[model samples]
Target chain A: MARKLYELAHSRAGDKGDVLMLSLIPYEEEMYEKLREQVTADRVKSHLNHIVKGDVIRYEMPNISALQFVCQGALLGGVTTSLGMDTHGKTLSYALLEMEVDL
Target chain B: MLRIGSGAGFSGDRIEPAIELAEKGKLDYLVLECLAERTIALAQKRKKADVMLGYDPLLEKRIRSLLPALLKNNVRLVTNMGAANPIGGAQKIIEIAEELGLKVKVAAVTGDDVLPYVFENADSLLFNPELFETASILSANAYMGVSEIVPALETGADVIITGRVADPSLFLAPMIHHFGWSVDDYDLMAKGTVIGHLLECAGQLTGGYFADPKKKDVNGLAYLGFPLAEVQSDGSALLTKVPGTGGTLTLRTVKEQLLYEVMDPSSYITPDVVADFTTVSLREDREDRILLTGGRGKERPAQLKVSVGYDAGFIGEGEITYAGENAYGRAELAGAIVKERISRNYDEFKVDYIGAISGHRGSFGHQVNPYEVRLRVAGKTFEEDKAQRIGEEVEALYTNGPAGGGGARKFVNEVIGIVSTMVPRTVINAAIKVMEVGQNGKETV
Candidate 1:
């Protein structure tokens, strides 16, 4: 399902100069803790290498819950095609909602 | 007493409509209210982000077009569209007047946006530490009284733009300033405030929101007519709308608007007067006008009230319907099963049972018989995910329940977080000052 969503978003943007940020939350709390032990920031960065181009890939772990992946500059034509707005302000909100990862 | 006019909710052509009516109808004062509560909140958010440019940059363009007509018609304008950027609003109006070669003095009334003041004094004022935690402080506006506006008018500003003056005070100020109506003249000022309230929403009283079904059918009703208050020196006023407009002005419509948006009907307080609505009487006049007579006003309150919001915990709820021999009993059983499942997963959870059909049995006026029941279960937890899980469990009840036929149908769930904050009440202690400038001087009124 995650790969399908990625493919759909990629097809919509024509996959040129687009960056994809994938945010995932493991089903169980212990599963995330185990994944944390196995995956370092560099390994996660390498895993996301296919999606990252010129922009940076950032990871954030909110204290309450959830791990968020932020991909920049990968969106084709930036925000105009992504969120239908020409501003960086409105596009940021659309990008956050688009990268949904369900565990 | 100063004679001031106050009204709200205006758009397009700025003061031309008011000035035209004032000139053609020979009105003594004109007040326009353009800021809604939500507009103030949005403006405050912009100000906090340091993007406060001016109150609607388009306002000056509209005002520029209307100045010549306003000056020729001798209509003094007061409005609360200034939002959090009154200074910016004033400067733009001044620039327009200069460009048009109209010597109009513009005075801006400030100190209404209280976000900075509240933040500075939060430590001493707020009782709870959590009150200052979250940033939901969209806007902080002061409900200024008539006393503040009279002085700015006295300063001889032909156009006065304010932040968040109370809706009625705009009308009352011109009356109190021109007529010398005493603060204790509650009966007279109350009449003025009532007049202001009726005319506040423009066409609202004049058939815009009238209860008459025919008003809904009236053609060209979309371009609502603005209100006009004809005040007498004795404190009696006539409320009417712009001429040749497609709307009704009736006592019933005026009374309905008087009761709308107000918390207490008896003590409807403005800056200059605390009006007792019970004393007001509305009479339909010859034209599309309502004569407001005998409103009892009283001393203004000491402290001005402010509204604030804070962060609260998250909540989620789901509902399902049960129809069977023992529908109510089965609904209760379904709630218990969901509670048990949620408790096994999380230790801290708040659960509530809401029954929608419990009152229907008594209100239907028929012999009570077996009927279907709708049960709603809502749970609140610190963790948002746990709240979502509770919603999932409630949805699963249709397949898993006692009798294998709880008949749980049409399940719906929603999750929402609460924001808790208090609006600290304060007093506008500044004394009223009225300064007069000559008509030929830089300031022209």
Candidate 2:
């Protein structure tokens, strides 16, 4: 079944310069493997293509059942120069959660 | 076990939660981690304008409100609220102590500023050449380590203030001081570094950023409690908050904070050690306590990271609202008019339908014919006069049709851009000075 990523996981976003770092952690321990196999860097890059202008790199943390994505060219110019209302891109996590994943 | 409580996460954090921690948390040390990346740079600009005014603006108010509780509980304080001026900040604390009829000792740590070194070596430094060539440099500060802070803690001072130090270093100093851990001990350094990173954001581990309606709910958010760590000699700690407070301290909250802002899971670099978070383990102790242990570490870096702040330009922003039937269409019209009018003078511009397209850039799709919407137009320009035109055109929409435009507002802000470079550790020096005040209002240096 096709389901929203938010139904199975929760995420948080942090920023440094023009790069955006987002962490994805599953709600259940058993779901970690499914998220790892299904949610790849290319999938996320294509999903948020409208928002992120550059490449996305994913790092795995099996001990904590979490994944971290470092997306470049994400913030328009960064906090000091970005014209967006949420200059820090704190809302980018919710936007990542809005993606649809095959479950 | 040594108990340490987080007073304030940033410069302008809530005051009452810190007071609650001081009054009831039974803490041995209270560390307030302020000073963001560009904060010291902004403070340096102010110091250039006037010598004694570069410290945190709320230092007096914060010290005045928490002094009684801190003194009564016999808890020592450590902070980077000194910003660009640690000596000035330390003097202000002494003055406040005398006024409140209390005796206190304050230690100030200096030598984080490396502007002179940066200027001498700017040609060899690794940074954006274009920015370095055109922009005027404002400030450059190297992140100091626990080596300087431990001496201040050793002075037996009631309060310790510094200009720019690593956020995690603030928490690790007390652990190193109390436990007498050697800096070369990488295992202990990693464990202490993880604990510091988890608690550095203050209320974050206690549910400040972990609330969602109908999905993951948190109770009593109005009186959210800040976090404290109970550390043992073996480099293990219990993360919890004061009882009867408004937040939760479960394994879930701890796990969320464990990876917050962390780029690499295995290697998180600080001035003291390169911490490995993958080895850490967490378990729920009781209702509101979580036991944390086992974060490994490697050797420290030979070079220090420096934050460089410079003038970018100005941001001119304007917003106006349109309501009552076909609001989206009318808002779009207003956005087009402003963009067309200002495109000649401004090269870079941003137009957003605030209620619908601002945050996600219309990725989530828009509402079906919303009753009201706000239109925002902004531009980047070097001249303040040119920036002012963006808002002027937005406000002119009142009489120029697009119908029902109201609540027009505009702003122009000077922007400061930040970049980073590396400097050899030996290029910087750390110094500490202590100031004391007596009960009779007599000041001694």
Candidate 3:
């Protein structure tokens, strides 16, 4: 079965400098492995290539059953220096949730 | 057993919610973390102009509305609203107490300014390296911890004001002051830091910022309640809100906030301790209570995070809208015209035809042309007049543009922003002073 990432997980975003961090936690503990296999830096980078200009780094948190994505050079130049409205890139976590996963 | 309430998370947070927390939350400590990365720098700018304006703008409003209740509840207040000038902020609060005819003690924490040290190490701290020789910094302050704050809390100060302390430290100081927790106890410090981190954002931890509609459903968010940490002596915290308030307390919301702004789960750096978010686990102890456990901490970092504020010049933006037949074409033409006119004034400018490919970062042209579109031109320049010129060039498109170009608007605003860097702990030498209300309903420093 195929489902949207939002269907399997919920996420939140925070920022440091121009870098944005997104945490994706699964709805169920069982879904963590599926997310681990399906979600990768490449997929996330490609999925958000529309806005993310820099590299995307993904860290696995098996203990918490979550994935943290650190997207660099994403805020046009970062919040203080950026002209973009989504300065903190709070909306990007939802954009990551929009990703689809095959279960 | 100590209960700390989060009155505010950031500078512009809603004030009424804090009033509710002060009146009904039954809190021992009400901590408001208002200063952000760049707020102090901006506050310094305000202070340079007027001695009275450097603190948080809502300092009086927050005090006027919540002070009486806060005093009635015996819930001492602590906040970094002191921003760039804690002394001025404390004086303002003392004046408020006088005007209200209420007696309360206030404390102002100082010595975080490191501008002199920044100048000494200017070559190393420049974000652009080129700024080492050329740019003069506007403000520089080190992120302080609980060293000065705990003593102030011990002085029985009803209100504690600080400048540039770590956000969680605002909450952690009360914990240490009341519980007699040793500052060197990394495990307890980490646990307390976890509590501070959770409640620092105020509403974000309690589902106000975690709602996703279908995926996550929050109730009555219009009046979302702030967070409260019921912390035990053993370093365990049960997070809840003033029951009967808006918002949800789910495992999901707790989990999101648990990792908010964390660089590494194993090592979340702060001035106080290198908190380990990985060790902590969340469990729903009840409908509205989430228990946080297993938090451990390591030694504190050697370098405290320093926020460097410098002038980023002025940002001038102009926008125009287009509709009807050939709207996309007309908008694109308008963008081209503005770009040609504005680029000559500055070396660079951004032109976004904000409907077809604006969101895509203009990487690929959209096959489906939008029925209506907006043309926006924006850029940063050292001169305010040059930034203003960017908008004027766009307005020129009204007469020089294709059919149906309308809604032309432009404005310019100066930008004050912080650059990321670090400094040694010796640079900040944080100090604390207590100010109180005299018997004549006047302030005594």
Candidate 4:
């Protein structure tokens, strides 16, 4: 079945330097492996191509059933220099959560 | 077991919750994490104008409001509220205690200020050394660890003030000092660091900012309880908040916070240790209580991360609102006209349709335009007058260009921010000073 990532998981956004770190956790603990297989760096990179300027790195946490994506060059110039109203990219997590995931 | 209560999460956090924690939480230590990356830089700018006024703006109110209860309940404090001036902040706290006729001891940790070292080694910054040469650096501070702060707490000081220490170290130091934990114990340090991270945001773990409607509804949000950690001698912790307080403590909330600002699950770097959260596990023992275990750590990083704040020109921002039919078109036209007016004066300017694609352009798809939208234009310039022109141009759109532009708002800000760099550990020389009242009820440092 195809469903929005938000319906399957919950995520939060944080920033450091010019990178936007988004943590994605499945709503049900049993779906951890499914996310590990589907939410690859390439998949996420393709998902947020317009939002991110550089490469994306994904770190997996099997025990916690969470995945963290560090999207580089995603904040324009980051908190200090970015002219965008969403300076810290606090809402970028929603863009990732809006992606369609197959379960 | 040690009960560590989180008081204030940031510089402007609510004060009343902290008092409640001190008076009723039955805590052994109270830790407040208030300093952010650019906070000290702004405080330094204020200190440049007047020497005695560079600490946290809410320092007096936070301390004065909580002093009576804190002293009465025998709760000790550890904080980085000394934004740009630890000595001045310490002196101010002591003076406050004296005015209330309460005996108290104060301690200040020093040597995080690396402004001189930065100027000397700007060209040799470990990463991106080139940025420092051209950056008009304002303040450079190194993140200190438990090394200096732990000793200061050993002096039995009622309160400790510090500059830029890692947020987690505020909660971890007292644990290290009280439990006599080995400084080289990586596993324990990692566990403590994780607890610190959870409590550092204070109310976030206790539901200050995590309430979502329908999906994750939280109860009694207005009186949300702050977080506290009941840490064991074996480096495990149970995270919870006060009883009958608003906000829910659940596995969902803890998981979200665990990864907050963390780069890698295997190597989360801090001055004290490289905390690895890869195999960490958590389970709810009961309602509003989560038990955390299995944190691992590696050797500490040799170079400490330094946050260098510098002047970054000025930001001029202006906004205007349009409503009813064709509002999006009118707002777009208003944005274009303002851009045309200010483009000549500014080298670069950005126009964002606040209510439209400014935030969610990607996922929102190509739907019909919003009935009403806000148009905002922001520009950066070296000259204040030129920065002023961006807003002035936007304000002119109401009478001169747009038909129904209302609620026009504008502002100009002197932008200053922190740039990250790493310096060798040998260069940092952190110190600590403890003060107490003598036999005559006079304070001594």
Best by lDDT: 2
Tens digit of lDDT per residue, candidate 4, span B237-305? 999888878888999899989988887878988888899998688999998999988799887889888
Q: Taking the tens digit of each residue's C-alpha lDDT, what string does model 1 give over B282-345?
A: 6667766777677777876666644332323344556676775776677778878887777665
Residue range B323-419, candidate 3, lDDT tens digits:
9799988887888877766677763477777776654454332275788998888887778899998888888887877788888999898777678
TM of each candidate vs. truth: 0.56, 0.97, 0.94, 0.97
2 against 3, candidate with superior DockQ: 2
* Cα lDDT computed for each candidate against the true fold: 0.54, 0.87, 0.84, 0.86
- Candidate number of the best DockQ: 4
**Alpha-carbon DockQ of candidate 3:** 0.53
Ten-residue stretch with the least lDDT total in model 3 chain B:
B357-366
RMSD value for candidate 2: 1.4
What is the lDDT for A80 in model 2?
A: 69
Which pairs clash inside model 2?
none
Off by over 4 Å in 1: A1-103, B1-25, B48-54, B120-132, B136-138, B211-220, B309-445
Model 4 Cα shift for residue B256 (angstroms): 0.1
| Model 1 DockQ, alpha carbons vs. true complex | 0.01
lDDT of 1 by residue, A1-103 (tens): 2321221211111121133433333333344454444334454444434333454433333221233344454442232222111212222222322332323
Given candidate 3, what's the lDDT at residue B80? 91
Task: Please give the range of 10 consecutive residues that has the lowest summed lDDT in model 2 chain B.
Answer: B361-370
